[model samples]
Target: MRILFSGTPAYGHLLPLLPLERAARKAGHTTAFLTHASLGDLVAPAPVLPAGASLEETLDEFHRTTGTNAAEDMSPATAGEFFGGIRVDLGADAALAAAHDFGPDLVVAETADFLGPLAAAHLGVPWASHGVGIALEAPLAEAMWATAAARATARGLALARPFASVDPWPDCLQRDDWKPSRDRITVRPEAHESESGSGSGAGWEAPAFPGREHLPRVLVTLGTIVDDPEALTEIVTSLAGREVNVVVALPPSSADGALPVAGAGVHVTGFVPMRLLLQGMDAVVCSGGAGTVLSVLGAGLPLVIWPLGLDKPLNAERTAALGAAEVVGGAGEAGEAVVRVLEEPSYRAAARKAAADIGAMPRAEDVLPLLTARLG
Candidate 1:
């Protein structure tokens, strides 16, 4: 079976499917990763998202108009609709073109693509949604789903996808949980098999790091943007020249902007293959960006989060309250908190254990078979 996976950025979005790809390939299925060209490095040989892109521009427009960050609003209705615009549809043509070239049996994406649902309908193929439900994205129409019994009996029947905000958020975010879906895969194996949950490091085998093994490494990154760099930088500076080896990822947009450091151990890089680098690192001090947090959590690398904007803070709160991480006020306390985490073996142990759990959870690749069967 051949499957085409579409996502925005390859790092966070594509990763959930990595273990899946490995599984699918091992099972003799062919799979390909499709994403925008600019964001392709994370997934090599990625198909470009057509030229004259507008998502970034539209977001800039949204930011200028709203003066509030996207992550600030947890609700999709209030996420303000920038996500549901035509600007991101710039990639549809390329995605469709790639689909035609690859002639895959299924289309899998995180939530939905920038291109609205029309493209999927146009392709005459089945599409599957995956990812941690973000603020209950544009609600699902009740008329969209097919009866489970009817759909089960008739394999080709289309299921009604639920609205993202069908219910509310979890306890802290909401008063109740969502009306569960029959096909939904929310319990990520990556998050579950961790030492924190039951499946600690089930399928994961840690890769070895030779030279930098001794130092207690702390990966410093606010992900793509520092939402509030002024505040986020404080958290980073706090870790400077301390007990941890601070590897700060300088924003490519920063042109190496000066990040004041006090200690000699603070090393800043334009970029670091953190997923690979984390193999040797002890913990991560991040801005709680969705990508960074999920990646760190999936790796079972416990965290020290200084949420700057958007979903960072919320993700930080949820993961921390659950014992997977620590949420700090700002860069002001980031340094001290990191030291405490490192000096105390419990933090490291918890993170390592969490890593074990994430390893055991069902991964995105696991859905390809079902996706394939539906598309076929």
Candidate 2:
């Protein structure tokens, strides 16, 4: 099978796909990834859209659809950026020019890959929603979009547009059990039983960080796009000189010099091989972005979340309530929150259960089989 895949820059969005991507390769199917240029360099090289296109185009469209450019639009923009960006990103994700530019038997992506579904629908080919984040129930996601419409209409801006018409989740996966809907992952064989990709393979080294072997490690990330260094700063200070070891992967800042200043007790890096990082860490204190949360869960570690910016708060709500982790409001008390979560055994217990929940998911590598059967 030939696959054209589009994913976002957020580590949460991209990394969960690695194991699955490798799995497909092991199965001997050709796969190509569409993402940021820098990241494309890190992974197997694939076409990259303009690096800033995601935020730029998304913001432009949000303003256009809502008819708000100045301050009137700022509030909703802060809260609903991801929810609204999908419409603007649709064309690219679906590979409009990209679709014909690179024809594939299938297009695989998360719901955020706005254009993937449309392009697949347009091509009369199969497009599977390879979610790395939470499962967006087709109906519930629609309702959330509709809620955005109400906000737009209240301001007398533009009218609400139809974003999704079908159920986003496949019929078989939908369940009302109220657990964190982690990635319905499928790892390709190259990634499943193999550590080659995690080390040096194909001229790329698997993501890993040094000097963290002996500490009771904690991973704190705010993802690449929606960064909050102030929160990291606060976290380090809170744990200042504590016995526990804390390591943060600050992307976008991409600079070890940009590491969060802790009280000589915390260590930070611009990037860490996340899969390897998660395997070694005891827990994560994050903004609850999807890829990181899913990875941690996939590894069965507890989570202490301080959701900031975009879908994080919403994502936090699901996992925290389900005993997978704990949630702090934001950067304000990030450090204290981390301390509290760690002090309590309940957090660890819940995290264990959450990990088991993730193990139950179908591996992300099996996309072809699932799609073939579903659309057969």
Candidate 3:
């Protein structure tokens, strides 16, 4: 069987599907990824077909069409509309072309890939939606699907709902309102283990900086695209003043721009492999991206989350609801939140429990029969 995967051009969307893609190939199915040009590195080993708009172009068009700033707060309705436009305008052509060329019996995609289901519908093939984090609640999912339906009709094709949903998120963390259509297969979150060591580290070891191992160490990272210069400076400086060891990962573009070095206690650098970094970290302060949040939890580390935008706020809520993390508003509140997570034994206990739950879910490769059954 040939299977094609499509997604938004971000690690948050693509990373969750990696384990399943590996599973399909291990079972001897031909697999390929269709996404924007910018996400090439994340989808390695599997052949990638370049798709629709560039990441920058998609963001610019979203900003232009929605008349909403990506930096500021917006309603879920606006998010739905902006992303629906992405499916219709940026992704459809490339996805259709890839589908035609690959001739897949099945299409499995990240939940955010609006184009995947549409393309599957056009080709009359089976498709499945893979959940990235917590399942979106009824209100949000319904609103987003409403926008998707209109977008599909405008292009003269009806939307094809997934034949099944592959859920990697733990059941306890899911929204109370989430209800799937009878065919939901759950897989364990792979955490950062799958992406680690892949050229990001290229076999580099964690450097032995003096006093780092002795102090109470905390790792802080806002994701690649979303960061606030002022908030980062405040968080790093505040943590440094507390005498805790701080390691921060900054996007390459802004690494030299604004973060003022507080002291030798604070270390600033580019991306650090989470597999290695988690070895020394007692706690995590992050922007609540799904991959980061699940990775930290899977490691049994408590965290403080300050969401910047997109699905982060919702991810934060779900994690905090599970008692594994504290959700803070900004950098000003981060220092205290981190302290609370460390001092409260319950938070650590809860995190460990979630880690065990994550470990208990079915592995991606174990679900081959479910994913490929339609072809038979």
Best by TM-score: 3
lDDT of 3 by residue, 46-165 (tens): 878787786667778778876766445435676576566654587788778877888888888787678777778878888898888777656667667778888888878888777789
lDDT score for residue 221 of model 1: 76
Residue 205 shift from truth in candidate 2, angstroms:
12
TM-score (C-alpha, index-matched) for candidate 2: 0.71
Any runs in candidate 1 off by more than 4 Å, and if so which? 9-11, 18-34, 49-55, 61-75, 78-80, 88-102, 112-116, 132-180, 186-215, 227-233, 252-254, 257-263, 344-346, 363-367, 370-376
Prediction 3 global C-alpha lDDT: 0.78
TM-score of 1: 0.71
Q: Over the stretch 89-179, how does candidate 2's per-residue lDDT look in tens digits?
A: 4334334566666677777765554445444554556666555544554554664445445534443434322222211222222244534
Better of 1 and 3 by lDDT: 3
TM-score of 3: 0.91
Per-prediction TM-score to the true structure, in the order listed:
0.71, 0.71, 0.91
Give candidate 3's root-mean-square deviation (CA, Å).
Answer: 2.5
